[model samples]
Target: MKLILIRHGETEGNLNGIYQGIKDYPLSEEGKLQNLKLKSKLENINVDKVYYSTMERAKKTADAIFDFSSSAIYFEENLSFNEINFGLWDGKDYKYISKNYSEQFQSFIDDFKIFKFPEGESFKDFYNRVSEGIRKIIKVSKEEDNIAIVAHGGTIRVILCELLGFNYEGFYKFNISHGCYSLLTVCKDSAVLEFLNK
Candidate 1:
């Protein structure tokens, strides 16, 4: 079976550098157009099913690509894959965070796994959330199908870690951009990355 992971189109938080966390936010206007362009780009692929995060941005992207025409289109909250809860930092810009809390900002850049944003979650917590969704996908998918998942960048990084056998500390090295795509082929023993950030 093949698994395709796609990050949702840009959000207002993406453009503004705000920590969106698990809060519900719609896609920006440019995001919608980006998703439509992505749909046009992927129109030829034989996608058997489309699965997406319940977050509006992700769902909107999935709808643009698959149009919910196949019964295989599913919105899974588990797949919504929560962002690292930013807590008090949720609405702050990166520049503000870096200037006011230099050490914390450096921790995020230098050692994300250990960076804790006051009341927010650790990277480990976010990793496990994506892991659960991965497990579900592996158990349910047929050998012949190509499954597409529309989720967040954080979620895509976890999928990359699992598929590429990357250690916990290297998660930040994988850069899945907004509206970018990845392809993972799953066999009996392990998963192989075919394409990344395409």
Candidate 2:
């Protein structure tokens, strides 16, 4: 199987460096342009299925591919692919979070792997959810199927980590840019990264 992991185009929150998390935001004008470019890149590929985050940005990005690819059977929206919930931090800028929730912010900076957001998901929980989602997709997909996943940067990074056999601790090591996609070749027992952040 082949996995085309796509990060949705930029949203207003993304351009302004706001923590969007589960808060819904549509693609910005620039983001739409970026998606168009991505669409062109994938215009000729045959995709079996597409799975996207329910967030507006991801939906819009996925729509581009779905609309262009005649081979795409269908696209499904999955909450498991949503960005990590930021809870009270949603829509806040880093400066604001650092100043207002100083202690929590410090703890997050010190050890983010174990830091749970106020009323939001912990990293461990988020990883497990995403892993389960991937497992379900793999379970139903054929070995020759081409699958595309349109999601947030955080979600894409987690998917890459899970599929490429990277430690969760190296999550930030991947530079999943807006409107970019990576390709992975997967088998029953192993996966190989073909390309990244294209």
Leading candidate by TM-score: 2
lDDT of 2 at 17: 90
RMSD of each: 2.1, 1.5
lDDT on C-alpha atoms for all candidate structures: 0.77, 0.88
Residues forming the 10-long window of minimal summed lDDT in candidate 1: 73-82
Candidate 2 per-residue lDDT over residues 1-198, each given as its tens digit:
999999998898888999999997778999998899998888787888999988888888888757745554767889999999999999999999999999999999998889899888898889888988988999899999999999988888888888878858878898989988899999996899999988
* Index of the highest-lDDT prediction: 2
Q: What TM-score does model 2 achieve against the real structure?
A: 0.96
After best superposition, candidate 1 residue 125: deviation in angstroms?
A: 1.1
Off by over 4 Å in 2: 68-72
Q: Give the per-residue Cα lDDT of candidate 1 at 94.
A: 80
Clashes of each: 0, 0
